[model samples]
Target: MGTSNKPPKLLRMEDYPSWADKFETYVQALNYETWTAVEEEYIIPNNENGSNYRLSQIVEGDKDQFLREKKMLNLFQQAIKVENFQLLQHNGSCYSIWQALLNKDRGNPDMRKSKMSLLKKEFDIFTQVKGETFAQLVERYCHLVNEMKRLGIDKPDYEYIDKLANARPEEWGTFIMFQQSNPVAYARLNLARFIEKLEAHELELRKNHNMKSTAVP
Candidate 1:
């Protein structure tokens, strides 16, 4: 029997469409930390439809940033392309399968398993927050504030700081603002830790709800 030739690989990054190549180049220049921060701030929420209310602002912000630094825009585009490619590779090329998995009722066990595996892999790549409870987060925030005060610095306002350090994942914007203010050298550092804790809480909520449903049988 004649051997079947494998399909050629997808176009190289340089051979991609002009826009895509530009974006890819921009993304390649960013350090992993900055790239991850940008992805978490923009791309993830957009994928989940969490940016519906802020779509205009998000687009405008992107345009302004891109205009100011074409490289940054290119990186943003590249990161999104990479994410899409990963999803497609995982789920196969069947749009029907994708739709079924996206639809709550029609989703199959296999699809769910695949998706859970993907989520686990992605979550593992991030730094998990140390504390799991709300109180623990609050305590960390207080400690951070006190440390700043001890150094004879005008610390971030306690009220605003508490609001963010203890916020739910849905309140991600609040935490981003806190990171920007940088009341302490560890502001973003602590915020990343707190976000990891929130991810654990969200998973627990899903698991408990699923258990409650199964128990009804």
Candidate 2:
């Protein structure tokens, strides 16, 4: 049988704070002494092969290099603080605007104008959609209107279901109820099935209308 050697123990750096501090102090002291010795040894020009560069040259070069590095470090630290402050200020401004838009009291005119402008832009975009039936328009408008209501935006006096029925009487009864009651669930699960049914109904209507037109001819 072969004998196996045990693995060496591993110590974590975090587990020896006091020892690490003491070790660092001892190392710094040794480094200073060794650096002095190297300086003294290099003063006499002995023609050793690779030991041509003296400690004095390295230290003198490193002084300027260290100062440049420190300046760069300080610049980055200040930049980080400024960036954080700007982010906080922007966040606060957005929050204030949102609160003002949702407020019921007749407050700032600028806030009211901003809110109205946003609403008008949204409405105009919806109104401009080509190839969308009146029913589609009603659905889109109802959803936006409902969302605004949920967010404490001012509600219109007219009923959404009534508007939907006026737009497309054929689909309004079923579609409006489902949209109003369960908008999320209707969108996620029921829209495809509802559209399929609407297509079938339209097909049937088209067939019946064609038959009537032929009979009249």
Candidate 3:
């Protein structure tokens, strides 16, 4: 293999259609199984029998495939720039890491600034959609935050929390008011704690609505 033990190369940004294409080309030249690790997302061959398959009983083919995937991941990680590494920090598999990079701005490095600008605009106007549960809203908010962080745009959590607070629906008015009244407590609330409280309140609101609907008229 021409790329023998050579980490996947991060070529000139202009060479590929997207930021991830350079790595894709490198991986394609690595080897059959390693390339498949990213393309087909090769998985360990499973046992045909219904019986439990022990770790010690893993076949040679499956073991070789697993090792190849590990090598691919290690090479990709070691070759990527530190600033760009965040894109794959949460990803485990070769396919996942590759997908994360491809999802970033187009091959043009200049487009990154524009992409960040678009993300900021979206964050400024972000709000929970109607019929979206509090948990779902939090999940969406976190995903946006992660995307921004991956691009090196770090916004204060507290500031974003305030943005989230203001986006609550009319039914959340009382809960919002409660948080507003206790400024100190609200200031102390991080995203996780805020989500916990919101989930509990959501449950209570649903329970009350159900009881009211079932009451004798």
Candidate 4:
């Protein structure tokens, strides 16, 4: 998409890696000088009080460099969709904007190595979010697993099931305990089958809850 007139739109935060790479290539190809500007400076602070334009006017006297920086900043603005841009609070400059988005989606360089640990923590703490639908929970669960895979933490299907069981909500306690006691049966389960079983158990829990709620006092 960056090959076309328009640069690739990073529709989802997860797509940043490829999108950033393509956008970088596009910027370099479009104008090497603009790419040079990006490496030259980080974003200037913006505030109604006062903005430190042109690297706090460090490049202010250098008219040519200042112009290149502005042009690169404009390109960053245009690259992101208007609505998406509005949704974010990106600082000006190619370096700052890129760094901001990168940190937002994927943590900074220092945090990169520990990303697997962070994902594991996320998986460990993950549970049905308040007011989240079963389908939505499943979607989030799947995404987390994919993230773990991206970080090179591939596990057997049954291992995934074990983790999922531990992450389930309180309503799933009985079903989880049953599975826990029957290791062989649970070990045979894959992601889909495990989720299917959870869904069925959820319905039973719901039915019982409804029955008790409607019971005569």
Considering every candidate listed, which one attains the maximal TM-score? Answer: 3
| Consecutive 10-residue window with the lowest summed lDDT within model 1 | 1-10
Name the regions of candidate 2 deviating beyond 4 angstroms: 1-109, 117-130, 154-158, 169-217
Any runs in candidate 4 off by more than 4 Å, and if so which?
1-13, 16-111, 128-133, 212-217
In candidate 3, position 27 carries an lDDT of 65
Ranking 1 against 4 by lDDT, winner? 4
Q: Candidate 3's error at 96, in angstroms?
A: 17
lDDT for position 6 in model 4: 65
| Candidate 3 off by > 4 Å | 1-107
lDDT string for model 2 (1-217, tens) is: 1112211111332223233234334423434332232122222222358443343544664544333333322322232234333322221222232232224222367866676667656644444255786457646776666445543566343333333334444434565465547656544543335445455655776798899999994
Task: Give each model's clash number.
Answer: 2, 0, 0, 0
Return the TM-score for candidate 2, rounded to 2 decimals: 0.26
What's model 2's overall lDDT? 0.41
List the global CA lDDT of all models: 0.41, 0.41, 0.70, 0.74
Sort order, TM-score high to low: 3, 4, 2, 1
On lDDT, the candidate that comes out on top is: 4
Q: lDDT by residue for model 4 over 146-165, one digit each (tens)?
A: 87875577878977887777
Tell me, what's the RMSD of every candidate?
Answer: 21.8, 24.3, 14.7, 11.3
User: Judged by lDDT against the true structure, how good is candidate 3?
Assistant: 0.70
TM-scores, in order shown? Answer: 0.22, 0.26, 0.52, 0.47
lDDT of 3 by residue, 60-173 (tens): 657766777777877776667665666443446777766666654343466887878988998999998989877788888887886787678886657777788888887788
Model 4 global lDDT (CA atoms, 0 to 1): 0.74
